[model samples]
Target chain A: MTIENYVILRNKKLTEKTFELTIDAPELARLSEPGQFCNIKVSGELIPLLRRPFSISQVSGTEVTFMIAVTGTGTGILAKKQTGDELNVLGPLGKGFGIDDTFETAILIAGGIGVAPFPFLINKLKEQGKEIILFNGARNSAELIKLNFENELNSTDDGSAGLKGNVIDLLHANRKLFVNKNVKVFGCGPHPMLKALQDYCSTGNLNCEISVESNMACGFGICQGCPVHSASEDKYYLICKDGPVFNSRDIIL
Target chain B: MSELDFTVKIGNKLTLKNPVMLASGTVGYGNEISEFLDLSEIGAIVTKSISLKPRKGNPPQRVVETTGGMLNAIGLANVGVEKFISEKLPFLEKVNSTLICNIAASSVEEYTECVKILDKYKIIKGFEINVSCPNVKDGGLIFGNNLEAVAGITEKVRVVTEKPVIIKLSPNVSNIAEFAKVAKERGADAVSAINTLVGTAFDIYTRRPKIKNITGGLSGPAIKPVALAKVFEISRNVDIPIIGIGGISKWEDAIEFMIAGASAFQLGTINFVNPKAAKEILEGVKNYCLQNNIKEISGLTGSYEL
Candidate 1:
């Protein structure tokens, strides 16, 4: 319900299709934790009626970072935005990822662009020195994720750059690393990949957490747009309000 | 002719202090935006669509942004007509402004029920029959696209209230002029052309739909051209005044509506960006009329001809 204005301090492209936009959202940045997102003003023009929602990938001081992919005109324009331009962004919205230092051996699995969460989350988890095992999957080596698996846990591209096929596939193929150990997993990417990961976590008994996406209106829970299935309570929770982040068993998806 | 004395009358009897008014459904009883800005300054406050009975509205994810506009499927979430008359109406009476009750009905009986409830309130000077709600299942289109349906609903509400009846037109119809002519003939006092146009959005990465409802009505600058077209078409054909609205965020857009034969205008979606935008636009409209040497504000209507 709190409305604040933010200027686009920096917009840098991490890939051809994706750009990392940093806005001057001091309040949002100060309040933003790991799992929260923001609703951004796509353009100054009035044609596009609603603001687009994006996850807050990184928040440093007054700048809130958004890892946006140019999928449509709204985001395409956002990708083309230069420095010093002003973007009206509503922030630190929705429920974010939670971190606990209770575990030591943590495994991070990312699917394509789903790699967004782990980089920031892993940095926060590294202080625990929990031998983090990373499983990253991409379409082909061409679309391989550009980030080093934080602590060089383990990197596998779909097109056989480092390892072959998918990230979960690579893990199942080499099951020795995950032999009945209670390793915490965090994942975001394609739904099928996350589903497969979720299924594998259930069978393999791995404690995993996955982030979900849905129709997000007011990223702060007011609109109740982003509804996700709650497996525990058997109710639909607003993805924007309840979470873009959830435990692997907490959701049906 | 001058700003101090200019009172623009749209249709026949609906006289507004100015030629600008807030659009229906978006302002939410004028209380939503007035929390930060005053509601009295604008020409009129068009509350959200209130049906006869209290409706729960659409499921979550009622809105999404498109190329130049946004889409919404907010199925008229209202506090019902009786409650609106009892609770909201008394509050509306306190404001030094006219109330344009935007009503929606699924059936003829429901429409009459809504009017009968609203007729008791003295504050409600006008009624905008929202036959163009796009969020409901076969609701917005059923009464909107058909010229006969439009006329029937217009007449249904017209007979109940002595106040001016504004039949809100949806842009989904093929020929908008035909619909407007039907409403004018059916005893509609005036017409508000072009409610939200039908459109949608999706996340290509997720390979899934953007909005949960799958489709919603597109509003904002994206539909400005469509709204202007509907206004121009209706204004040229209908004898009554036309109130143009769609993606109207600035003075230039409002002027375009006036030139297209709209006697008055409304703002939607722009309210979400900055709550104070309406007051600023009202000021801008007054300044624009003064600067352009427009003696009468209504004189600016339908200035743009083919």
Candidate 2:
């Protein structure tokens, strides 16, 4: 866990509402794991006091980046940042995906800004010499983020891209991908998309791990604000600590 | 640098190393957040309030951010007292700070029973009776709102444990001082004023409540003024020590609370934004005392002039 005031190295607008911000954070860049996130102090003001949580979109040598969608005041401020502006970020907090070489094909599913953490995970999985299938989805083709993967599968809610519906429909349409193969599914997206993916994985008995989003006040386990119920137990787990990533069968979503 | 005293006495029993503590439910068991900061730096660690039986807490949409603060309807979701001792206490025992185990129950009997179970743990320095949780079904705000209920619960727990008793009061009541007087009369060592005031927010687009529980406790900088008034009121009326809570984000706020008659302070929502808030405020307090030529930090307590 590292907290530092990082200088904006780059803040590029991907779409009208989406941005990719690069910060000069050597310690955080070196320490951050895939699927883990950072809680950024959005503004110096007190009205919007709580820091916003963002996944580690990508980490290069000395720079940590986050793919931010300017949905509210916090993200709007972050998206409009000038290069060299200082921002306080506490991260690579929370548990990441359990990446091991036991499985053959890694089915990576992402929806919209959920595509943020995948670029890092792809690097790790490829380093382990694992075969990867990337499924990317957005509301429309214009909303999709461009990735460098050669085996990328695309989907748009409208019939503007590869598939006409969301990522779930795309996953369902390509059913043969998981059949008769040692496959494990990894997903991160909107709640509905992740739920649909979990349902699909549960029925097929395919191992799935998903990164969930919640209204997190603290990225660590302190302020028990973000709790997703446990599937096997009668308790609630903090998304920040127990996981932003969990086995599909372990949580209620 | 001149030596400054930060030690504080709760009634006649426990003495804290400093005046800064992590508010109940803000930091769990002291272990989960120990990786971020040294627990011993904090004066005390107030564990999440535990009930006699395990509680699942309110359903989803438990928290939503407001203008300057956030609303939480956590409903005292904790691993019951039995499991708490077996699971959470092991790590807490190793922490060097004073440990105050907060407990809440739906009934008076359950409250006493919970305290009895925790009495055997030598590491626990005190008991913080949480009668002010607004999200629970029966025990929380219901017990905290009534003076008779407040006195009844405190008296029951006071007899079972030799540790200092701190009755955490709710701010939703008509008169916070009336309840503080009852806590003082019932052998409580101190009073933690103003647990999150009951509040609600709405989703303007959906035309529905923001929180699933409909109403939740409002916390953060927004509640500081209201909490300060309550502490001021309680200070004038009650004789025992007071631990000020709610919206204390910086040292200035801590000093203001101390001057208003809070001997110690607790950090809640600020912990979410800055995990090292307590340490920063502790250092600020020492600096304030040294700069002001005050020998002890306690000199600021009730120093407000009319």
Candidate 3:
């Protein structure tokens, strides 16, 4: 992992609150994988002291992008940055998505800002010659982020978008698309949504991997900050070290 | 340019190449941060608190960011002393930096047993007894808050090995100086003042504590002023060498700790934000000494005018 100041190339507002920050970090971009993340120092000041962990949303050539939502002070500082601004980024950290499995079809599921890690995963799956299907969901159309996936399906709770209800409900409604086919599911989003997806995958016996989130200090093993319950052991797996991504069957949620 | 001496003597036996040591719990086993910077360049790296058996640590929501600081209740999560020797030590031995093992246990016997098991490792330069951890329910603050318990743990552990024993004192005590005095009187070579202050944060909407442990030890820039005061109080009242800890983020903070009475300082929370903090702080401190024409960094210790 490398920690260096990368200049911002773009900070485009994707939605009312969501934004995409493109950074000029060739080394990190090259080292990063689909499910990995970068811990960004939002400001030089100590008020928001800890570096905020953001998923490696996308990488193009020498630049790395992070999908951000202004949830608090850290992201609030990130949202205000202009092009050429330098950001201290520590990455590419944690285990990324496993794309080498013997599945012919890759199903991507995203919930609101959980849509962050999918674009990168999509890039990798396409390279591996896997068919792609994406199910994106948000509370409303205003909150939905359209990333122009090949086979994109959008959903909103207000029915103001592609389908009514949540992303899990959308996936359930279209279960026939992958039935009896060699398909693996990839999901990211809030806990309640991920938990529901975990249940849905387990009941359907579908192979799935998920990118989880937590309030972490150091996006490494040292801080022992972000821990997810282990399904196989009686111990806790650190999200920053063991994973920000895990097989659905391997973790408790 | 004249050569400047960056070395410092902690207690009588241990001598570090510099005064900047990575605090325990902040740098686990020296593996993760080793990826960002060379570990050998550091003066010392304290291993996370090792117990007789592996601790699973606290549940989820173990840490939360506070104003200018962060709260952590990791509950002394570690791979135990046996694993430290068998698995962790091999890598640390290769790093070639001064290694000070920090031990935490539920009883005095457990503390000594841990030390006795680890004493045979030639690579370990000293021991930093962590009796001040506020997160654990059993042994942590119980021994730290009690003067006799602190004395007993230090005296017993000191008997098992000739290595330097540095008691990591808690800032939550009524009189931190008294604890330092008792540690010194019981044969502790030095004392690391101000482990961390007991603090907590709440989620108003949920009406619950941010950390699952309800409360955690607070560190970072927020606790620097409090840490300096505790170090000063101990420096004035006690005779033992002081290795100051508790929120030292930069060289200015490290120098301030020395002037206030620290022979050495450890970077805690800053390591999380900047993995190369030790290297940067070391450079800034060296430049500070050269600019001030201070020949020996140790001379700045306890040099406070007031």
Candidate 4:
């Protein structure tokens, strides 16, 4: 489902650069799947004309929330949006994570604000009665979003949090946790972290899926802007349409 | 208030429900944005340019947001003519608006061959001759700039198809009216003015070009004024209808183009900012006609006074 010009229900600061915005898009919330994202117009003006894409973080009834990192001018303006401010949003775009009863254990990995798409995935996975083990990493403790996951572990680059290393390092240190279980890995983070996770999973011959990010204009297949090298095919796949999520073995990473 | 007539005829071959269209390349082959918009709201959907063979387009960073506009060097990536007929044309047929196929090639023969294959399909309402693309290695800007090349291609396509043939002109020319006159004389049904102006953007930190092509076509509000001026010049030179394109984000922009002698308008860069902008502008024009007591939108065409 796609909703345009939805009003913001909440826009709050999570950290210095990271913020959260909840829009009142009931149709989008109902149709949204984990790993899918939304494209938001930063402002009404043409200077910052292109809409920025954000992964869906949480959904509650008519409200859909996004975890945004103020990276550039587009996001900086988005972060400044206030409650009751109307924004043009088109969403539930791209292919989402393949979550089903096949995998008994879901090992979720995130780096920095890559944690944005996981909360909703966790919520859905929990409802399916799957074992959830979340591995999250950020620059520091303040950068990490607070969530309720009893089996969660974390790392911070500055060593100001649970584990004093990157998320991949934390995952590497705790390899035994994924050893004998019927586990399926799901990851979202910076490219390096996803690459590291892909290496670890492929090396062990484990099943894994990952969410990919690229610079995109239309959050649909049209512009052909966001492309990831296809692992099997010689052609490139659009991250906006083919996936924000793909099997770790299916993409070149 | 009396109802205002929004319908318009293009070259006596096709009559569109309205004058506002979603320009080629901006709106994908009528299917990608279907979920976000109502296709019926638009007068026509011009599919992205297709060539005789498939093109992979340019490398990443194909698009970059600039001040009040954007730059794109897509290199005319497409599935070729055959795949478009098989894969894309089916989806476009389901759309409610007129379907205009935009064709581009490196040579006159390639353009004619591509159109010959497309000419068999009745789903296409018209053909938009795309000769202004700047990203191609050859024949794009070359054919559109040279009078003989423009006339040769226009006459070739005109001989092959009975459908309306609209020539897309480049803005980088010294005197655009001369080119428009050539296209008009060669049997072009209408003219869609001012394809993106060739420009380049650089990242000061890395001292590297922002686009992989090193140069790209600039579109958006930044190019609107130039588009309007060229459209006005072309309108004065030729009696054919002009489809004004570039930086049109609102109904008022459409009105400005219509007043300047453009019979219709196409929304380009603004589609990236707001997918529904074309539909909004179409509705806005209708409301403008109703409030102003205008009987026909064509009445505004060339209505500009000194």
Per TM-score, the best of the predicted structures is 3
Q: What are the per-model C-alpha RMSD values against the true structure?
A: 5.6, 1.6, 0.9, 2.1
Ranking by TM-score: 3, 2, 4, 1
Q: Report the lDDT tens digits of candidate 1 across residue range B129-201.
A: 8888777875577888777788788888778889888889889888988888888898988889888887777
Model 1 preserves the real interface contacts to a fraction of: 0.35
In terms of lDDT, the best-performing candidate is 3
Worst 10 residues of 1 chain A by lDDT: A150-159
CA shift at B58, candidate 2, in angstroms?
A: 2.0
List, residue by residue over B31-83, the lDDT tens digit for candidate 3. Answer: 88898769898999999999999999999899999999999999998999888
What is candidate 1's CAPRI-style docking category based on DockQ?
incorrect
CA deviation > 4 Å runs, candidate 4: A146-148, B1-3, B36-38
Please provide, for model 4 over B164-263, each residue's C-alpha lDDT reduced to its tens digit, 9 standing for 90 to 100.
9999999999999888888889999998997999999999999998888988899989988999999899888778889999899888999999998888
Q: Estimate, for each residue in B1-306, the C-alpha lDDT of model 2 and write its tens digit.
A: 557787887678989988898999888777767877799878999999988888878877888899889999988888899899999888877767679999989999999999999988898999999999999888899999999999999898889988899999999998999999999898898999879989999988998998899999999999999999999999998787999998998899999999999989899989888888888898898888888898988788999999
Query: Where is model 2 chain A poorest over a 10-residue stretch in terms of lDDT?
Result: A216-225
Sorting all predicted structures by lDDT, with the top scorer first, yields 3, 2, 4, 1
2 or 4, which is superior by TM-score? Answer: 2
Q: Provide the TM-score for each candidate, comma-separated.
A: 0.74, 0.97, 0.99, 0.94
Q: How close is chain B to the truth by TM-score, in each candidate? A: 0.95, 0.98, 0.99, 0.98
- Fraction of true contacts retained by every candidate, in order, equals 0.35, 0.75, 0.92, 0.57
Q: Please say which candidate is ahead in DockQ: 1 or 3.
A: 3
* Candidates, ranked, DockQ: 3, 2, 4, 1
Clash count for candidate 4 is: 0
What DockQ does predicted model 2 obtain? Answer: 0.73
Those runs of model 2 whose alpha carbons end farther than 4 Å from true positions after fitting are A176-178
Q: For model 2, how does the per-residue alpha-carbon lDDT over A1-253 read when each residue is reduced to its tens digit?
A: 8777889989998987899999989899889889999999987787789999999988889988999998898898998898999999998889998888499889999999999999999988898988899999999978888685898889999968779989888988887876788998999999999899999998989899999998888878877778899999878888989999999999997
lDDT of each: 0.75, 0.89, 0.93, 0.87
